[model samples]
Target: MASTTPQGLCIHPRQMDFELPDPLPRHWHGGDAFKSHLFDAMSLQFPDGERFFIDSVRYFREHIGDPQLRKQIRSFIGQEGHHSREHQVYSKRLRDLGYDIDRLEGHVQARIRFTQKRLSPQRQLAATAALEHITAIMAEGLLRDARHLEGAHPTMVRLWRWHALEETEHKAVAFDVYNQVCGNRSLLRRAMLMGTFFFVLDTSRGLVHMLKRDGLLWNWRVWRGGLSWLWGKRGIYRPLLGPYRDFFRDDFHPWQRDSLELLQRLRGEFDGAHQAEEANGPVPS
Candidate 1:
């Protein structure tokens, strides 16, 4: 369902089998429980979270007037739809390993339910726009930083690389939709501020839950490594703070942060030959 756009962007989905065929190691990231669990904890949030993203965008899909963005909506939906399904299978891997993935997913799902029920349509779209910004930046970090996936299982690495690539491809769709339909700047900014807070809180809660379950809650090694991985010399989170704050700028848009070569490289590395050959313009090799 993925195709090239007029601008030469590959706007389609790459459907891959993210299967955990073996008994997965509890700590898959370079054998560090904290590092592995950090990403796995984040995985717990994706299935339902991505669904909410799809729904928020879908809610506004029919109303979009631009043909290019309208087409982009379909591609965005396709990409996210694949991400949700793949991550569902991916989450089950952690669930099978006794990480209590379902419990956290339930809490997150309930939170999404509350947002859907209580927030205005514009507010919901604004939230989606804000959260998409978070994911896009996070994806950028993962793609740009080799250490994020280094020492991880091959399957996991490929899966995440694929996700990062597609997230880059479609990062602007929801924001564009929000911009077209909603003109209230404060709603967008306010939602972004709250979204960042909750995103970190929820991710931490899930990671801590897994740590306690794995009986590594007090492990100083994991504590040290996890802190270092996120905040150390080559830490992923520190570099993102500036980009994260960029969301508050009034003229900000996803394209303002360019990483086109990153997109090309990841797609070339992970995409099947067929998918790659079909990419038009600047999106494919």
Candidate 2:
């Protein structure tokens, strides 16, 4: 199954307590409601989504025999746990802003419950692996490009960059585990198709809800500008298309795209900050 992930890959959790601004700016992404909510919608899903990823991978943890992969599984759980906690705070910020965070999260929670109850463990892990690929590609796109967060609020930008960085680090953990346990390419392919559909659906639902709450649901200009930014010539998401399709290839491995250099490059920005947060102690704001 395309050989396991790179031999020396180290996956560890980076503890970061991002101080999200009080009463987060209504349109933190360049004062653009569409841009901000698009990300917000996705963030809203992370708390529940990440937990499901943890459970799905943890289900197969005991079945894995490789010592290195087993260690990665632990770190994967740790990283995702931290992500879920941090995004819960982000969700609370949205709640404080009157966005009906509970209602949105309820939908994701319900879906995960049903999946866990009805789907096979193999299917569950396949779904997790597929979703990881989805996040991994987007994470790489965000780190490699600037326009995605151009004009975004500094704190929000840092929060996302941190999440993206970790996502890149452990992106293949679930896939590697799935290969070891269930090596079913057909199942993984189907999971990707279904996972992508629901991801888009749920994110869109959250986006529309936020925009509706802000009274911009029907605004044509908002739609035009946001759609252009996503799919237009030189769009931020346009570059992800090729990488997204690579998951279906017979010999595909997450490391084949070779983002090790990019990961090392981005680590410089975060690792130092985390080290300082440790050395100097977190100053009381």
Candidate 3:
């Protein structure tokens, strides 16, 4: 099973009052419909998804005895709370753009409700840990690669980088909590399987919905280009395959990937900007 969280690790929330563009561009990522909708699909899932993550980790807060773990738990909750609120704003931007935000969210809400009602608390926590692993790897990918956000709008880029920074900060919190409360490798692996299925399914459904609205769903050129961008050599997600598969190992831990250097590098960039933002007063909403 996974070891305790890495030594000297600390988690804290950052306020990133992102003022997303009033009317978000339909093709915000380099004017590519597939790329923009893919990101939009994931953003639409965050408000509710972050809440579920918070509740799952909170359910086991009392079970943890380590002082540091408990402190990290509080910060984790705060960080995810910030993510949920910011993404709710992002979702509203999508709504204003005429995408069916309600319909996309309803499907995720129904699944969360069912999981809470039918699954055990341990299972719920396992799912949270599994999903966290997924996000953590993707966050690391975004941070390590400037190519991922190349040509994106500046404000949107800032918002995503802020999110990625925090995600990297608390990447291990849920995993540590799960390991403390229930160290069942079998359960975790199963959760990964189920969680990956729904994540892909929901993201694809939302992507399709937005593309259809934009009248690009049937455009073969868009699919051809997007698919190449995602799966071809040097693709944005191509590097993440190994990290994603590492979750199934018997001794897997989030820090085994050893991203502390990258984390510190970004902390300098984002923390400096955040301090400046505070000094400048709140961003005009």
Residue-pair clashes, model 2: 0
Please give, for residues 1-285, the per-residue lDDT of candidate 1 as tens digits: 121222656676766776764577888887888888888877778889888988898898778888778777888888888888988887877778877777788888999999999999899989988999899999999998888888998888888888888898888888888888885679999999888888887889988998998889998888997898899887878999898888887777788788777777667786676877564322211
TM-score to true structure, per model: 0.92, 0.94, 0.94
Provide the lowest-lDDT 10-residue window in model 1: 276-285
Quality of model 2 by C-alpha lDDT: 0.89
Instruction: Kindly report which residue stretches of model 1 are placed more than 4 angstroms away from their true locations once superposed.
Output: 1-6, 277-285
Which residue runs does candidate 2 get wrong by more than 4 Å? Answer: 273-285
Ordered from best to worst TM-score, the candidate numbers read: 2, 3, 1
lDDT, candidate 3, 1-285, per-residue tens: 636566766465777788899888879999989988898999988999999999999999999998777778888888899999999999999999999999999999999999999999999999999999999999999999987788988988888888888898889999989988898999999999999999999999999999999998999999998998888898899999999999999999998898878876777656665543221222211
List the pairs of residues colliding in candidate 1. Answer: 2-12
Q: Which residue pairs does candidate 3 place in steric collision?
A: none
Winner of 1 and 2 under TM-score:
2
Output candidate 2 Cα RMSD. 4.0
Ranked by lDDT, the better of candidates 2 and 3 is 2
| Candidate 2 lDDT over residue span 119-157, tens digit each | 999999999999999999999999999888999999999
Give the Å error, residue 207, model 2: 0.5
